[model samples]
Target: MTTTQLAPISARAQFRPGLTPAGLVTVLLGAALPIIDFFIVNVALPTINADLHASTATLELVVAAYGIAYAVLLVVGGRLGDSFGRRRLFLTGLWLFTLTSLACGLAPTATTLVIARAAQGAASALLLPQVLSIIQATTSGEERSRALGLFGATGGLSTVVGQLAGGALVAADLFGTGWRPIFLVNVPIGLVVLVLARRLPESRAHNPLGVDRLGTVLLAVTLISLLLPLMEGRALGWPAWTIALLVVSPFAAAAFVHVERRMERQGGTPLLPPSVMRLPSVRSGLMVAVPFFAAFGSFMFVYAMTLQEGLHFGPLGAGGALTPMAVAYFTVSMLSSRLVARYGPKVVPVGGAIVVVGMVALLCTTLAAWPQVTILDLAPSMVAIGVGNGLAMTTLFRIVLSHVPTDLAGVGSGVMTTNQQTSLALGVAVLGSLYAGFSESLGTRDAFALVIGVVAVLAAIVTVTARRLPDPRV
Candidate 1:
């Protein structure tokens, strides 16, 4: 594929030699770190609880804090990137994320670790939005498509690696670091990223508007209202406050929309521009993205629990079991751009079909094998899910950003990432809860089957939504 150099947006547009190989790898590494950290904590949580004497509630907070802060701040992070500069925000975010990670590793108490994780999540929000925005600002055409595909691949691989690596790291107990290596490992990688980020060409929105303080507050509150309750409610036994927050969430969301609309009418810059949503690509692509990621997020959560708890596998064994699927995912994701080129929007629906078939096959295999099922027995199902996920993720990412204007790249990316992150968290809350609830009554294997079945249904919805997407060439 040919590189598309950054087009001049104004007389002062920075000279960018498109995305250099080094520059692309640098930003993609930056993108992968936050995602890896998100799931890496799963295997380490037991060790953390034992080491820090953390209560169950505090342990849950350790995970939820990062996710809540990350989701709530993402849109604002995007706007900041647009208003200031993508490279500037990205570098700043990376630095903060590195430091916060260090704090997490060194914290002596659960509270301190929870606080540090929240800060790390905020830093991640800042770091992640700039990745796609930079790509959106710097490249176009086939170059843009390929970069997005790689971004999707990096995202997919990082989650799996986080699980496997987390287990391995904890087991190795490097330098007697115990669970600390997972966070500490980011220190060296972040420093390398810091050096490489200097080579990234800086870009910002032309005629960038002032930050929308009111809109930012409303949006953050709205997301927090919805996400906080969902993520923590089940763990906390559905407190009355959780119910209240859930009730208020819709109103908060409505208020956010009203505020943004008013800001747009007053000729102010909204966090998400009104016109951007008018693009058929944005609306339809997000419709599919939400369910696709929701299924994926919950599947990972539920599958990990099943492997460790129900199947009587240790952390290392559980993580290793997923390696085959990860391999399949990475391999297929590498080739997704070619598939998209051949099939256009049809690629998404085709991917959905594959995922359905995979889930059904896995369901059958799990039922037949039951207590004796091994990694090799589930290999075909894992490979099937990976291939389908690979195709859907890469192609859909390209479709969502394909039609966004360069000036709106930051906000557009923020919206897409926010949709994805929220759905992922929601998947854990809603679908994970369902699995937990079912496991109490039906036992582990049956509950897992039920969750997989639910995910397949969600994938079917993605197929239907994919039909509404505009042709990529449009």
Candidate 2:
């Protein structure tokens, strides 16, 4: 319970077999695929809809199914890695992801694509946590810090890259395959990474616990009950079933909490440990993560819609519009650690404030220019948002993991990522639906401006809460 008790764990970690540069790159590549896939489908959705003759609800499912499955299974995946081995789970996950990607590419129906996507999500859940767990287990001090920074940068940039890549692939229509290449492209990349991953060193918990069946089931039920209703309610015309599910969600979540606490009291491993959640750094960092990621997810989703549907941009143009933001994000993310080293955690609130400014700029521009606004006109605001995002996201990862004991690395990473992915899905469900509803009555331009304003408010909340994060020395 004291700082001295944790020192020996840190000292032992410093002597562990660490990742080679090649191995680090391999795992980071593994890290990128899932985050990229999440946003990649946004631009490709229209094309997928047309070719498969899919309905609105089905298209939403294409996105939601993967996200929901990934979010739900992440902690279990982490536990499996701890119980078996990180490298083993990583390789297994990569192979499964490749197969599922192929399944998605070759699917003849929308329903088939949704099922395949869910499988892909499961594979990702198995794959991603090991990246961080491996880093925590193998490296120490500056090396671990740098690895995590690069990991954060990969994650943030992948969101923009996903949409960009999706649009380019859809527009290329290679062999007249159209949007199918968006998923098909992953097959070769996954294979190459699988080969490279053979070199990664294996690590596992010293006393790995058995999987907690009741806890896993309850957590899944809680998330599904919450997310499914929000995602499908609008398209399904707010059915009685949706309302019932929504009503069930909170109770399910409470039950999950009670079970986890009880299991911990009984000296059994819960999917999420009460001890980890009780850490001030973990709890406060998560407080910042939820709203920040929710806003981020919704912003990306809604902005893509604005470009393609509202501005009438072609797929290529829509994706290309994000180029400025992507460039800024990459550049700033590389420099964010240096800034944190000097400025401490205050950098996060500053980043949040910058995001608000960018959102406000975007709102003003949208109001004034309407459908006439060009990508060139949007570049500055995009750059601002990108810079802000880069600064905040990298630091949030560090803060959450900063105090987590080495032995619980897998569980801690699992909890952090699950919170992140769940927030993303919820954002898309809530704000995306809000945008759609507003567009019907208020016109696309006004609806967009209103949503941007709401996003700005969320960013402001991030600014306020981030001020409370403990400023551990960089």
Candidate 3:
């Protein structure tokens, strides 16, 4: 290693590397929190229902409200981070999220808790995008890729950890808090993170600009129209209002795009820059990412339901069944930077197939072990899915950002995250709706397998999509 020679150092030059261990931990923690929350509640739903008297619709609402709102506001959040300071916004978001989590824990009624969860999700949107932007602006080359690999690991591991941790929390019922402990746990950790955030260096990638007030309103409306109904509709018995809103979703979505395009033409600040489409890597990566994420997203809910509803495992057992997956995901994801360096963009397509086969194999084992399964019995299948998913998910991330310019890193990241969030909602709606509709007739486990098989086909499509990604735009 070589060091730059300095004749004399100013007092301010002490500890000049901004991407210190503490800062990296801060960013990784921020990125992990929101993703973990998305899955953590799944295993605890039964406990929550018994304790809070929440109906199935309400439980689904609790999850959907957070996810939809986060998906909707994410790009705007990134844009705000760009205009304001990333550090300032990240700290404020962490504080808001911490407070909202406390509110979630304390709410006496299901309605209040759902509202609090939604607010927490919105806060998460504000906090998450800024983490990556800070790292991108703060590092280069090997350092950048390593940070990104850790980010991707956080994304996958969060899902596994959320389920496992939420289960343990509910099972432990620390100080007899029961289901409420899940939300309450975030409060203290969040406070500590926020305090540490104050000393973090402030960074911004763009000149300050007015918030795109109209675009924000339009985008929120579009997402609500599309997302709210799908999640709530089935439980509500597919009301006409749900259908009406869904039918109008395309137009609402169209209006948002039209408005954004007009703003770009007038040289106004758009929430998501239209120019990102000109970059082949960005566009193609999103194409593969959508279906791949759609599949990945549903598996958590589908498999949890399979274990609990189909096989009648308790919360600890249902959530614990995924422990092998978490271990497999972390172990294999650690290898991704090395794998990508060896194989280039080819890693994503190859890994996608491995993941599909692993899913199919897991489903087969699940079917074989029905009605008399233990977590240990599921270990072999779990290991397969875990290793395969670690490979695909970590590699998919590399494929998505393969050519992003450093300056546009935040928006590029926001776009990739938007695709992830949207596809997740889409998977739950479509695959979840399918499972709901068919499970009664086919039985829970069989119906889950059928729906997940359809999801697997979508993953295969993503593999094909990955093949087209290296083509540059004309």
| lDDT leader | 2
Cα lDDT computed for each candidate against the true fold: 0.79, 0.81, 0.73
**lDDT: worst 10-residue window of model 3:** 1-10
Ranking by TM-score: 2, 3, 1
RMSD of each: 4.0, 4.0, 5.5
Model 1, 345-436: lDDT tens digits are 89888888889888898889989998888988888988898888888887887798889887565556666766776777677777777776
lDDT of 1 at 108: 88
Question: Against the true structure, candidate 2 has what lDDT?
Answer: 0.81
lDDT of 3 by residue, 1-474 (tens): 000000111233223446766888887887777777777877877777777887555666676678767876777776677667778888988988889889988989989988998899889878876787677656667877887667766776776788788878878888878878788888888988887777777776445445677777877788778777877787788899999998888888888888888988998857656777557787778778778877876777677767776787767887789778878887888887788777777777777777777777777776787767778888877787777777777666566666767545555666666667777767776677677667877888789779778867886786677777662211
TM-score of predicted structure 2 = 0.90
Work out the TM-score per prediction: 0.86, 0.90, 0.88
In candidate 3 the C-alpha lDDT for residue 408 amounts to 55
lDDT of 3: 0.73
Q: What is the descending lDDT order?
A: 2, 1, 3
Among residues 3 or more apart in sequence or in different chains, the pairs in candidate 2 whose N, CA or C atoms overlap within 3 Å are none
